[model samples]
Target chain A: MIDLQEMILEKDRLIPLLRKLKKESRLIAPVTNKHGDTLLSEINNIDRDTIDLDRQPQNSLKSFFLPQQEILAHYSVDTTGYNFTAPEAAKETIYFGVRSCDLTALLYMDLIFSKPAKDASYYDRRNRSVIITLGCNDPFANCFCEATNSGPYLDYGYDLQFIDLGSSYYVAAGRRKGADLLNKWDYFFRTVEEEDQKIRYQLFLEARGRFNRNIQVSHACHKLQEEEVAETIWEKLAGRCYDCGGCAYVCPTCTCFSVDDMAIDDSHGTRIRSWDACTSSGFTRMAGNHNPTDRTRHALKQRFLHKLKYDYQKHGKASCTGCGRCVDICFGGVDITTFIEMFTRDAS
Target chain B: MNTNFIPATAVIREIIRENDTISTFRLELINKRVPFSFRSGQFCMLSVPHCGEAAISISSAPNALPLFDLSIRNAGELTNAMHQMKAGEQVGIRGPFGTPFPMADFANSDMLFVAGGIGLAPLKSVIDHCLFQSGLEADAVANITLLYGSRSPSEVAFTTAISSWKEQGIDCRLTVDAGDDSWHANVGLVTELLQKELITKNTKSLICGPPVMIRFVIARLTEMGCASHDIFTTLERHMKCGMGTCGHCHLDGKLVCVDGPVFSLEQLQTMDVMELGT
Candidate 1:
């Protein structure tokens, strides 16, 4: 056993250590662009880009693993007959500065795509990646990961988890890949001291207390299981929803997608899978123009119920990681937290 | 890694045009890998060259092993494109997916089939399976009856199959919504054919039709003393992946693609499905 489990790295050694890791694999970290927004971007050069670990990235780890619109297979239609060839295998990459809630949602994605059969394209990208999550010391404004029990600091499901402790970082390796990374760059880190352990626990407690929103996620889940939400509640939510599909795009755990074939020429084209929102009428609209769900009353019904009610009953854990990205993204005031508040209130 | 979405090519052997809008395409897998088998009420995701895919029911019984029938109506882009395809042309086929009707339980019971327009596609699979079972099993399906209703006299499909069933002594009664000069049969909804004698608890009423007809037929059958679990019907949804992943066929907590394309009336009672009055 390597015993490369817990160690401390000085704050100054972060960039140089990432530069070393970048040489072997493609390094993706939260980088602050010129427009003043932090995003998880590929680092062209180690020191040239501004890798901001302080702010939460505008996007989750979804698009990196499951691109917005990726070609699943390329097909050629001619005299030879219709045949399809898969897209190229994913490149080996290191994902750095991900939040605990984001990584929690990735674990949920793993559960979703592996059913009747494994989604080939999703697995191709998911298998070749190393995830390094940054524990939220100072939680983001919209973050309710504390309520969801997915964050501030996660106990599991990350390759490597980093906790900022003043001048140094407390790094814990949750998997063999993370242990190898620690062993490979041993000089950048030092042994964890007794004082380091005390401060880490103290910071964890502080982070837990810092969350402003106390969403009744489990209460809502329970209420949904027992009785259906009042039709007026659904109507209120659906009435305000503009059907922009922005929340689903921003949400880390909403893994629903649609597959369609597009043509490049008369002979060849590609089969593509794109993100789909259950709120949209087109998500369930058949070819004959028959839609089972009336978008007026049921637009937000599927979205809320799937995460809180149905998924909870099926998985014993709700799909909502309480990242609260949807809370910030939805301008219509119909976020998951709003529904949960209304549901729990009405049920109580 | 890529075989998940890649559909195997199947050649269309024959196309039986039933009416102006409906046609039954007999397809055989060119490669015949492992020998594809599907129970009655299971469907396949058929792919057209330019068009993506649509979930269509396998209207044929398992006894027709290597060959299966897909009774498609000209309802959508892929279906319209399929209507234009000729015999000997190849099309992509993936899966014989979703839950199947429990033929073992049904083998001992009498069968009553109610169908409307293209809704007859999946019920036709069950009806034929019951007929096929009667020939094989010594304790076979006791009695069989089909009450099919079409939009009009011209819209009545599977006339050839209906004639064959009548010769085999199965009571095949049909009705049409609109009557023509040549039409000599009863003109009314198929629900009117629901005689009190046929609504026995032991008789499994398999229904597939328009949502409205299914609603009315089920109401009458239940009122006439048929048990909820004994009344089974297959559902049609806008499905992309015939597997459970795609959220298209999501009815309540259950995915219709996997949990069912075939659900009993008792099962339907729990869900807030649109097929019912809800």
Candidate 2:
């Protein structure tokens, strides 16, 4: 077995460490509000209790890599001539206190942007940043990460995993970057004992048992490829689908986008590239009366199959990380866990 | 710093009016600092100030002159403004983006070209390259056949050039959906021209047209013994960016702007065909 070590962070010291990390790079962490919910926001001042790593954020981690709106190119047109210019690259950022499920979602996104035809824009951001995951002590009711091969603990993607052990937190380095970070702040952490490591693993196991929901689909991509599921099933499930595209909007793995042209001046225009979801009616509409996926049922089916099947066939893993943000955000009560269960059960 | 973007200026050299509805513009780089090389059947994002931007395929062969050709149909706002542009006008051009037609994969196999209306624009690039290379070395290319169909005889693009190719003993066939008194050619849907005997064995095909026409032609080709992998088609999606960043051109997980505007039927099958929310 690999020798494991932990760096303890007392509740009082958490804020100081965050403030120190902020000095070097931008630190984004979860903050709660009067609504009793939390959101990931850039932290200028760190209050340890304000950071809630228990629940997944309402929005996806995708906005960190692929923003909702980005200026792609700027153009200037005049009596003299027209000039075109491309957009600038992103800055260095450290996404702190990210949930394990969201970090797994980032792994799927890496597949989309790191394929043979790599996306330079995504590569720029991915290369410039470090992922700091916080292990979930209390998973939400909607979460089913265990069913999808993800859990409360960090697997391969995260640079660091912070496991809360009551009075103090145990920090485990998952990557060289994490080790280097720990090395920089060696004074802040005392050497961990053998007993502390055992307790951390037990706490993680207890947290995993807390998750109530589970996905039933086994080998999700292969089931989708079989073509056994008919149109009626998709239509039936889609009856409740609102076509809001909230699922995709909140999914870290959904990489659909749309290009926009903004007029900067009479002689020039700025072309903006932004995220777009396939769940919208206008997603596949062409100029003269051609829409390959014109029906809502078809679009809904496409979203799920793309996440569970098409992406897997191309990237070797399911795009979904069972983050369950889609489940909680959907107004129509369209839960992917239920869908997977019904589809896989019927197939079996 | 501005990263992940390249801006290039192109000057309009020539414009060919293909009917009252559509026209093709030829553009050459003004900077001339970098040599722009693009495969046939690849598209670029063409931008006009204030009006908008559209994804247009480079209809000129790389082996040809430095100029690139963009065929515009006066169907949308950008094309409407583009139709009024003069030869000296300048436009913004980005990319030669997306995967090009598999020319190397089809080498040594007999080739068939079927195009309809403005769809002929993309196919023209591949045809030009084949013809140019074949003229230099006849044995290097397979037997080339062109079947071009348009709404009417007056709408046929490259009429003069096509006729010249025909005079040079290139197997060029023309058809019209409806013909006039002046028209002396076959009148029918393009699919009707795809009689089984017309398709040679061990042949590859390139098709581009209206979605319905493409679907019908593909069905006919499959019936006539052409494998899905042997046939290539160019798809036009609502693309805002020529790069894969925009989600507008996505069919399932595949972004048409990046993963393809050119896809064999086999690749397209992996996408979910149902409409959203059923």
> Which has the greatest lDDT?
1
Report, to 2 decimal places, the DockQ of model 1.
Answer: 0.76
Encode model 1's per-residue lDDT on A1-348: one tens digit a residue.
Answer: 535499999999998899888998898999999999999999998878999999999899999877899888888888987787778888889999999999999998998888978888888888889999999989988888877879999898888999999899999999888988898898999999999999999999999999988898887887788987899999999999999999999999988888899989999998888999999878888767878899998899999999998999999888998888898899999999999989889943
Error of 1 at B113 (Å): 0.6
- At residue B255, candidate 1 shows an lDDT of 95
Clashes of each: 0, 20
Top-DockQ structure, candidate number? 1
Cα deviation of B245, candidate 1, in Å? 1.0
lDDT of 2 at B53: 69
Q: What is the Å distance of residue B53 in model 2 from its true position? A: 3.4
* Candidate 1 backbone collisions, by pair: none
Q: Which stretches of candidate 1 lie over 4 Å from their true place?
A: A1-4
Off by over 4 Å in 2: A1-5, A34-36, A47-49, A86-91, A115-121, B31-34, B104-110, B222-230, B241-247, B251-259, B263-278
lDDT of 1 by residue, B88-172 (tens): 8988899999999988887678899999998888988888888877877664788898999998998999998889899989898
